[model samples]
Target chain A: MQWLNLLNANFRKEYIEMKRYLPNTLALLLTFYIIFLAAFFGIMFVGDPASFEANVQYSIVSVAFWSLTLMTMNFIGFSVVTEAMRGTLEQLYMSPMGVWKIMLTRIVGQFSLQLVMMVILLFAAMLTSGQWLSLNPMTTIPILTLTMISIVGVSFMIAGLAIIVKQIQAFLQIFQFVLMALVFIPLSVAPFLAFAPFVKGVDMVRMVMMENLTLSAIPLADFGFLLINSMIYFILGLFVFHRCEKLAMKKGLLGQY
Target chain B: MEKIIEVRGINKQYVKRKTKEVITAVNDVSFDVHRGEVLGLLGPNGAGKTSTIKMICGLLQADAGSIHINGLDIKKKRLKALKHISAVLEGNRNLYWRLTVRENLEYFAGNRGLSRKDVKEQVEKLLKQFRLKEKENELVNGLSRGMQQKLAIAVALLANTEVILLDEPTLGLDVEISYELREILKMIVKEEKRTIIISSHDMPVVQELCDRTIIINKGTVVVDEKVENLLKLFETRAYSIKLGGTLSVAQEQQLLVKFPLCTYEGSSHETVVNINLEKSEDIYDLFDIFKAEGTVVESIDRTTIDFEQVFMEIVKGEKAYAMA
Candidate 1:
């Protein structure tokens, strides 16, 4: 009950925090419209018989999907580190909650708020692309699930790096500059042929997207390397967070700027 | 008196690996805070007051020391001890900045395990008490510093811990806000009868709220006494002297040797001296030395004392362990 209570409080805080960005909601909507136009009209004007909206197997959807997911992940992770720098971290640390409870609460809170964005994007894309609604639910479900888990891993990594990095402003700037550019890599690779371009990273995303990823697409080497990587990365993030929490407390910056 | 919190020989040593020099932040500090009393943990900047408070709250782990809170060992029973304490830390940075005052209150109250119904009622009560009823719906980030501070204290109160450790609660707050906070704290003390340990440099707050004070300097306590007692102790030291004439060189030397700290009130045509008596009979020595100078003492008047002067005197005069 107490843990649930904590989760509720965190959820409330997160909701209220995000609500102040209500003005930006219009901007987010406009961006979604632009992406839809780019997918439908841009490709049409280019005279490609490929109707991106009509095709369930379209690469454009995957690009837009991953971009939105990674953006949400980045927002949540950066917010935590920013709060740490601004000194709200100490108040959370001293509350009547366990360390794990505190971290889980924040993560869940961020996840819940970010779900709204995910929902909005999903509906906008699905509503515009109405013909491709009910194709391959079984295959799509696993890929979607794995992507969320991997996004969580990426979120954890960003949070961990935020804690370890010196000069928070500089770190965040550098991180955004690199990661925003990196989001297009998945975009660029999704449109390419499997064996033609033969890039290293896309093969990995495709490998995990397969039904028999661990057994067929790849050997059982590294004990299910993708699964292992996600798990290991999340654990290491938790470890770094715990250490940074203690360090800030000792330095008396738990409530300091 | 019942001991609500006992800190025994707490030691903290911070080692900077690059320089390899160990800076002792807290050294063998031990004290007891009685139930239902305000114990001011007074110290100058860098005097380890913050370190000691954080350790008691279980936000920090002391390198070596045992802290028992309400008879539960802090290190061994960390959660239990921490549950007994809540701190309104410095700068009012505790509350979630984007949450409204009401939301922040409800959030913390819920986190502390108050039921949903109680949280609603209690939050309303707190908003009224803190005078933030109108601003309850406003985001904390948009509020003024005073309002945010009041909200932070309101949040701390939501936890309803037995002991409230306030680390510089009045720091950076305007006079009126500080007064309001102090007033609210006083009410909480009386109504809840909660034991409070306030670490502050605000002497007036110390005088108004704290019954006793433990003054620390350079990671060690210099004085631990009742606030009233400290004021009274230094109240006797303030004196104004009436003189007959100026002093000879030998007489001035004798007077300095006897009093060690005398001010020549040249405009008033008197020599005022304040001395901590080594012995009660030291007055006879004072009389004889000044008498030899033919600087006739017309009258000696004791000045009324205040807490500020007492603080200065106590901090200025370090004890020499005379018995040793």
Candidate 2:
């Protein structure tokens, strides 16, 4: 019950911020869309129809993966930086819910809003490519949920870095490209890449979308692999984040930016 | 009265990132704040006042020692202990700038486990009490600095914490707004009977509101004494003497050497020396410098001491109080 109330408060706070920055949010989305369109046109003009169709499917998957990363890593990460700059980080630390729980609740709220934006971006990408990847809720929801666990971990890592480092835009920009590669690089080429964060979930997503495999039809071993890796990344992210939080507190840097 | 906050041996150090210089921001500082008492945390710049306040509010973890609020240890039970305290730091940084004034109040109250009905009632009362009813719907960013500060404080009050930590509450405010805030805080301290720990350089705020003060310098406690006592202590030794005649350059230099903090004002024909001596017997030393130049002592008046002068004297290493 207490968690629910905290989550609600966090959601409202983020909602108010989003509404206030609607113009800037829309400009960012439009910029991403234009870039997506340019890439789609380049592929259509260079490739044959059959290959173009395959590339469109990959693009849809890539969009989903990148969208998750952008929302979790960029939004959550930069929000932490902004909070520090505003000097509200200390106020959040003073809250009765504790900073970790407060951050988690804000992540849930911001990620939910990002999910809506993801949907809109996906539709825009589909319309530009003249292809639609049909999503089956039964398979898609569980796969997306599994993928989100790893994304949440990454968000935690970034937020923690924001607290300690104070300035992380340069790091975040480099990470955006790394996340793109994590999505586009085929996991089947090297099986050992399974341990990489979000690789298993992205591979599973591609199989479900490209191979038309239902949730149950996918082998139990593969599902277990994704699940286990998700849990590992989630817990590891928590450990790293808490360590950074402590370091920041020790240096008295949490409220400094 | 019970101690609402017990901060023991709290210490913090910071490393200058670029220069790699280690600085002890707070060093083995310890003090107690009694329930319903207004305790002033007074210090000069870079004196570890903010570091101490932050540790007490659970904003920054101490490298050593412990802070207990309402008898709950902050380190071992952070959330439980923090539930009893709220802080409005120096700037208006504690507020959500994008949210409306009323929304911030409601969110902070609701975040503290208040229900919707209670949050609404409490927020309305705070808006009125802070005289922010007209600007309740305005976003925090759109409000003036003083208004934003008022909202930040109003939000802190909505938490209903027993211990309220105000860091530089009257900082960077116009004279009128500063006076208004002091008045409002005085009323809250009197009526609510809430324990308050104010960290401020504003002397009047401390003199008017705080019952006791702990002065810090160079990350260490210099003096912990009651406000009235400190003022009185300095008042008895402070003097303004009207000289009957001019002093030679030697006498002026002697006065400067004997009393470093003293000020020599008025023309040579009618010079006056205002000085605060450490001891009443030190007056003889002052008179010897005057007598050396054959300067006649006209009259001496006891100068009224304000908290600022007392603070400066203490921070200057002129006096130390044995904390009781």
Which candidate ranks first by lDDT, i.e. highest? 2
Interface Cα RMSD per model, in Å?
2.1, 1.5
RMSD value for candidate 1:
5.7
Clash pairs detected, candidate 1: none
Q: What 10-residue stretch in candidate 1 chain B is worst by lDDT? A: B315-324
lDDT of each: 0.67, 0.83
Model 1: reference contacts kept, as a fraction:
0.52
Clashes of each: 0, 0
> Which candidate achieves the best TM-score against the true structure?
2
Candidate 2, residues A161-232, lDDT tens digits: the string is: 888887999998888888888877887777788888878888887778777789888888987888888888
- Residue-wise lDDT of candidate 1 within B1-324, one digit each (tens)? 899999999998877769989898899999999988889998778889988998898777788889999999987777777788888877667877767778778877766655557677778888898899999888888998888888888888778788888889889988988898889888887787888899888888899989999988789887888988877666655566667766667977877776776656543355555555545577688778877756778788777767766666666664232110
Q: Candidate 2: which docking quality band?
A: medium
**RMSDs, each prediction?**
5.7, 4.2
TM-score, predicted candidate 2 vs. hidden true structure: 0.88
What's candidate 1's DockQ score?
0.40
